[model samples]
Target: MPIGILTTDTGKLVEIRETITLNSDAFSNSFHEDLQFHFNNERIPERVVHAKGGGAFGYFEVTHDVSKFTKADVLNGVGKKTEVFVRFSSATEQLGGNDAARDIKGLSVKFYTKEGNWDLLCLSTPVFFFKDPIHFPSFFHAMKRNPKTNLIDFSMRWDFVTKQPESLNGFLYLLSDYGIPNGYRKMDAFAIHTFEINNKHGDKYFVRFNFRTEQGEEALTSAEARAQDPDYYNKDLYNAIEKKNYPIWKLEMDVMTLNDIKRVDYDPFDVTRLWKKGTYTTVPIGCLVLNKNPDNFFRTVELSAGNPGNLVPGIPGPLDNLFRSRRMMYRQTQVHRLKVNHNRIRINEPLYWKVYNRDGRPPVRENMKDAPNYYPNSYNGPVPYIDPARPKERFTIYERNAVDLEPAAYFYNHYLCDEGQRQRLVNNTAQSLVPVSPYLQQRALRLLSLTDPQLGIRVAECLEEALETPTPAPHAIKIPRHPYEGNKHYVHL
Candidate 1:
């Protein structure tokens, strides 16, 4: 029996089988039952974060030459196009939660460059909750509901920010209308992390990706978002593609030079801050248009794997602690949940294929028998290596003291230069943390004082004066999710 497909000039490409018709396959519950029963015995682990989502197919076309800034080929070719798939989801919500709800949506993009895959794991907002990756678990604990009670606790979120005063920049964006996006297509996506690009000459500059939506920026009011359908984002994407109003965004980048990094008051590698490290701001790079929707949601949208480790030539990795943590965590989680063949799924293996990484469960054998399974085997095996003429790798980071990632190795003080910035940080803290226990609140304020005095005093005065702070708007209710909350569901097959 042969698989059937509708090809050019053929009415229908069908294989005539003596025992069964293709139509009969529709009633094949037993086949499904056997697999699903096995699946039930197993489990589908939810992403510890970014639980629910929708994705689409598109191409990211280079619209400008950024060769002077970075060696990334995708940024060099003015008219070059790289295939892309983007998935949007609320970071804290479960799979069936409201899409337009007040929450940070994970804006993840995968660029299938000629060299390899490049994954940008970003939040809709440019800044994040915390800068130092060492405080990662603390940030999650703050966002999540109290362990004792399943309900949300503002005290948790406030506690963490209160301790980490530097988080004000990111928290302000969240409290503002920018927190809730109307839909995936209406939001400005980001390559939030600071990356470095090396040219063939071995010169390097910091890089950040900015994706401005062509449909225009839009956000729903908290009330409006709450009342909308749970699948609002998913519906908007699907319907737009159906109507041919294909969504698009231009890929822009802020390339900061080495001198730029030295001058900025903030560390560009800090995921928690968003400031131009260089004299030059975002340079026009390319445009990405999502024109095709997924054929199967589970295989593509839900199971898609993304990691910063997949980079092509000209594009080099930044030694950010968060990025390094993700490389190990993401690769481990994907293997643990979806198996080693997750990339072999049609949704992920659109054009690029790695031949040597064969002989796994769910293997599609994309290249067939001609391709060797082992590299440098007796037969002609896959011997692809780093292109020497492309971007050369940058400075190597010694891992001797980077293992525990001690606080001394991470914390920075340059972002506290401004009195207004300090005041705003303190004021925001005092206002947000007043409701918590006085002991904890005072402890937090004391910690803020460690970083900056004005910060500590203002927060104390603000909290003292906030005797009757008004209740947050009904829709202002927030529930944060931890990094590990959704991972328990995954069971190894």
Candidate 2:
């Protein structure tokens, strides 16, 4: 490589790069352009969710071969390793918000493999707030701040949640002790949706990934979290790595055959519910270790973006509505936030790649010189791989419909075995719902009653007590607007 000292954006030699002195007429063109270029593009849009995040550089090492499950080259054999970048975030919080806040955690990983980049997008909780993509905006608006007051409103939050009974399970999980994890290293992660994977024999299977932290799971109560430092998680991670203590997570997966899904009682692909834990076996895939801290936070951590669409050859496109909707939304937001060539950014870019995509804003590399831009040309170009091992997806025809609170109720009544845990769930639910109106409170009680009778009765009693002596809060004094009221902009108000 030639030794060249130049500006990062334009690759021009450094000449007259300094600003003009007070007595001079004007600054050099390079100086002015570099300043303007940097000033104009200093920041990109933060993620609508997962706004606050920290990341590290590491490698994912294959511990057990999964060749029978998928033909993805990264997981083909034991001892195989690939470079990875993992970003951990707290969803529903601003960039400056506290890390130990009681919220869902985002676990996004990018594997730079021999074939291409593969992103494993996941969350700390196994289930989500709702199943349908249409409820996405409503759910976030409810969880987020009230527009007029710029404060969290329990009335708005409980109203939408109570109406969508499917969200009750996830809501209960968030209100539990597991909600406020001690730190990123102590939390478990799950791929919240079903993914399609194929083997070299063209055999396909529905799969869900689970990453349990080897550090052992730990969490803090609401009072404990409030007493600790806000950025405790971020600082703990950085300090752990600096002290040569790397955090690790083992990758386990649940595999279901085509016939297995048919026999299951619930929808296997529902994001709001999980596959019964004992019904399927969890195969050990690999282990991920985060060992290096980022040198530049903005360059590596802030600009990094991952999507469900960035899949390898072995893992074909997902067919679930939630997965499909996320692919489209991720692309739209990435393009809007970081331009069409967002992947070309340093941390997100693939280690080795070739493509016909060229000539866009921030064209950093050689624009495939003297090569035909279109396909079917005489010159060599990237061609589509019609793989011999491509699996034929099994299609089912049926009217997709939503169910009531049966699944959420089942989990609460059966899965939660501890008496103390049950009591905590009831207390958390009551404390949060106490500020809302009686109508919404009763609605929540009805939904919870369907799940577990005692849960509903207990919450009802708490509400009755709370109603006799209501808490003094600003939001409780007035009626709340519609959940989507603040979404639209007023041009001539």
TM-score winner:
2
What TM-score, computed on C-alpha atoms, does each candidate reach? 0.74, 0.87
Q: Give the TM-score of candidate 2.
A: 0.87
Residue-level lDDT of model 1, residues 272-343, one tens digit each, is: 655643356768887888889888788788878887777767677777776778787788888887888877
Model 1 alpha-carbon drift over 4 Å, by segment:
1-43, 263-265, 276-278, 364-375, 390-393, 396-435, 438-493
Pairs of colliding residues, candidate 1: 45-490, 143-480, 251-286
Scored by lDDT, model 2 comes in at 0.83
For model 2, how does the per-residue alpha-carbon lDDT over 1-493 read when each residue is reduced to its tens digit?
9566655356765555345444554444666667777899887787888899899999999999889889999988899989999999998888888998889998999999988899998888888887678888889888878989988888887888778777877888888877888999999999887888899999888889889999998988888998988789899888999998999999988999877877887777788887886567779999999999999999888889898789999888567776778889999998888888888888888988777878887634677776778876777887776899986657652425675576677666776678877777777788898778878878888878878788899888876776688556665566789988989876995
Alpha-carbon RMSD, candidate 2: 8.6
